[model samples]
Target: MTPQRWVYLRKLLSGFPSFPSSFSSCRPRVFSSSQSAADNMAEEAKKLAAYSAVDNNVQNNHVVGVGSGSTVVYAVDRLAERVRQEKLNIVCVPTSFQARQLILKHGLMLSDLERHPELDVAIDGADEVDSELTLIKGGGGCLTQEKIVAGCSKFFVVIADYRKDSDALGQQWKKGVPIEVIPMAYVPVSMTIAKHFGGEVSLRMAVSKAGPVVTDNSNFILDWKFEHTHNWKEVNTAIKMIPGVVETGLFVNMAQQAYFGMEDGSVKVRKAPVN
Candidate 1:
């Protein structure tokens, strides 16, 4: 569905304490009360992409999957707004602890995979998105759950800022693939990945805390920078086979569509080729 139109969630939105405006046909515009907030083009772009995804994909009472990350934060906010404005009875499945919290904070009803295994649609932010729609997620350290939700969804819609769109995944996102591993096996796992792939595999460290990041599932993260790009599907498969590797950030052939908000605040929709 190439719904290229952009529409704001709110028409008269002013000060956004955390996180809209008129649905003017095909163009979406959001204005903030604080000039500083409005000035940040990156954030504005993120909001625009999120709004486009929600307006087009989210149906009333739909079972939705919400993902983690900075851009996705705006997605949750918009989803909540839709729920409130339309009084929609939707159940949201969260991909991480943080995602669950965001859902709760916005007063969105929460469920899990065990309860509702099939998601009507899922929206997430991507670290990188290639021309083929291959993605490198897990920058938010929730790859395992995020992948599960996306894979289970009927429609997986990725929302990212313009900076994430690239000809290839490695071109825009140079941080390498994020691999989730068991805490006990991180050292050996990093070494083994480097030995096989010929790139630096570093245990992802935490900036806020003293040690490495602990994911929602209490797993450690390793960022693997491959020496050179190869067939990413093959690379993803090989990495998943390594012992103690829970999941890789590589999202191969998962996304059905994507919305990239450019620096000029325009959203570009990419659709996978149909068989």
Candidate 2:
């Protein structure tokens, strides 16, 4: 919306004291005034971090990759806000069905990787982020698509709540490396993974369904709990050697930078380690 139009709207709205604050019925009800939202520290932090990422990096970002998961939800929301307020001409590429739904829900212009193969930047959430900015993602089973989208972006930026930032990737996110694999090969693949990595590999069971959780690609998910952390790139490479493995949650050196939302309503940014 233009400032002149905003001023006109404000004049029209000032007459009606009883009217709702927002006129857009399409917008989610969760967002209100920024100061009031800061009362909920965690949510505020997530919003602050997400908004900061979008505000700073989204300039001239014609093609953007929108990620799935909770934190990225805020990023999508902020993106939509910018689209409405500033009229940013950007097309969003979704990393998963969930992300696609968010794009549609917010009325953001949506496209696919086929249409925009290279993204100016990607905003994603991580299960865990280390000091070096190594990430553990795919907790939502969108790892394969997420990695693909991130890999195609000029800048892969991660946004998350403070709890996700840790001294090491495995320290905070204890769910283990989420691996996407073919259905029939899950057993053998799990066995192979355990044999080599010395971790308990288990098929991720669905809480709402009877059997294992499946990815958007209809592949089975295997959560491998390593006994401890090691060199991430080596670990990711070794796991990828298994014949049926599609992708692992271990995002080795993929992120260019990360924004962590702090409890005190502040945001912390960690750039990738200089190699």
- For each candidate, the alpha-carbon lDDT, in order, equals 0.86, 0.85
Candidate 1: misplaced stretches above 4 Å?
A: 1-39
Name the lDDT value of residue 139 in candidate 1.
87
Instruction: Output the number of the lDDT-best candidate.
Output: 1
Against the hidden reference, what TM-scores do the models get? Answer: 0.85, 0.85
Error of 2 at 144 (Å): 0.5
Cα lDDT tens digits, model 2, 1-275, are: 45643453444434433436576752343234222333345566788889899988897547999999988889998899999999789899999999999999999889998889999999999998888888888898899999999999999999988778899767888889999999999999999988988979999999998998989999999999889878889989988989999999888888999998876556888899889
**Residue range 39-146, candidate 1, lDDT tens digits:** 465687899999999999999879999999999999998999989899998999999989999998988899999999999999999999988899999888999999
Report each candidate's C-alpha RMSD, comma-separated, in the order given.
Answer: 8.7, 9.9
| Position 268, candidate 1: lDDT | 90
